[model samples]
Target: MKPIGLDKAEHAHVESSNNATVNSEKLDLSKVKVEPLFEKFVDFDTFTKSDFRIVKVKNCEEVPKSKKLLKFILDDGSDKERVILSGIKDNYSAEELVGKTLLAITNLPPRKMMGIESCGMLLSAICEYDGEEKLNLIMLDSNIPAGAKLY
Candidate 1:
């Protein structure tokens, strides 16, 4: 096969390879295909306005009869407290997650998951590749104030 290029000889070779008899009277554009670009973009300014805070995990336990649910008691530096349920059981043990600091979306409307009311959503970095999943729980420095909004 001849090398592919803009030259007339290369175009003739490509046409012959497909068993297409090119007509001199008509220009064949059937072999060309145009693909639409797909992309999704989010505005950062809109995303930055969410109220996210660092909270200390005071307690962690597995929910009854649930394989992937774990309940957490988060202290956000006020008299009020927040309860969150996270699906991190497969990534870390209950004992390992207790007493850790994490980021949570504080202002989200409360939602019930698996019959338990969750007040907030814990934030974590997750990556999946080749049918395997990995989760990296966010950890905060001790100096960071509890309930401090993440900018």
Candidate 2:
């Protein structure tokens, strides 16, 4: 059965975002190494304290004096725009990330980095692939509205 709010025509069954296929062939799993799972699990109440939401990139630019940081102006379904700085410049360019939908933790306390107050944290995946470190930001489907909470 479809979820409570979903319509029958909405089913697309799209492929996973990180399929990482090349020429219609899947990447060899042997060359990829993921980190071990956490030894301790947090209680459900503590997990729910984290407010994960969808955010849309309105504008993105390289931060001055930082080679690995990119500044982002995001639409988090709020009246005011949100600013976030991420250190993913080595893997992604600012121009390529504009207008993309992404997942972020919205209720974190503001933290200072490079003299900027980043209000939240963007979610990402990291692993060792092909003997090198690789990071991919947790992108969401464009259809998901900004500030939609994740369960």
Q: How many angstroms is residue 100 displaced in model 1 relative to the true structure, after the best TM-score fit? A: 0.9
> Against the correct fold, how does model 1 do in TM-score?
0.68
List candidate 2 segments past 4 Å from native: 1-26
lDDT tens digits, residue span 1-151, model 1: 1111122232332354333332232223444333444586668987886889999988899999898889998898778878999887777777867777789988788899999999889887654422344465777665787888888
Please provide, for model 2 over 64-116, each residue's C-alpha lDDT reduced to its tens digit, 9 standing for 90 to 100. 99978899999999999999999888878799789999999989999888999
Clashes of each: 0, 0
Task: Assess every candidate by TM-score.
Answer: 0.68, 0.83
Which pairs clash inside model 2?
none
Stretches of candidate 1 off by over 4 Å are: 1-39, 129-131
**Candidate 2: 10-residue stretch with minimal lDDT:** 1-10
In terms of TM-score, the best-performing candidate is 2
Residue 70 C-alpha lDDT in model 2: 91
Q: Write down the lDDT that model 1 would get.
A: 0.70
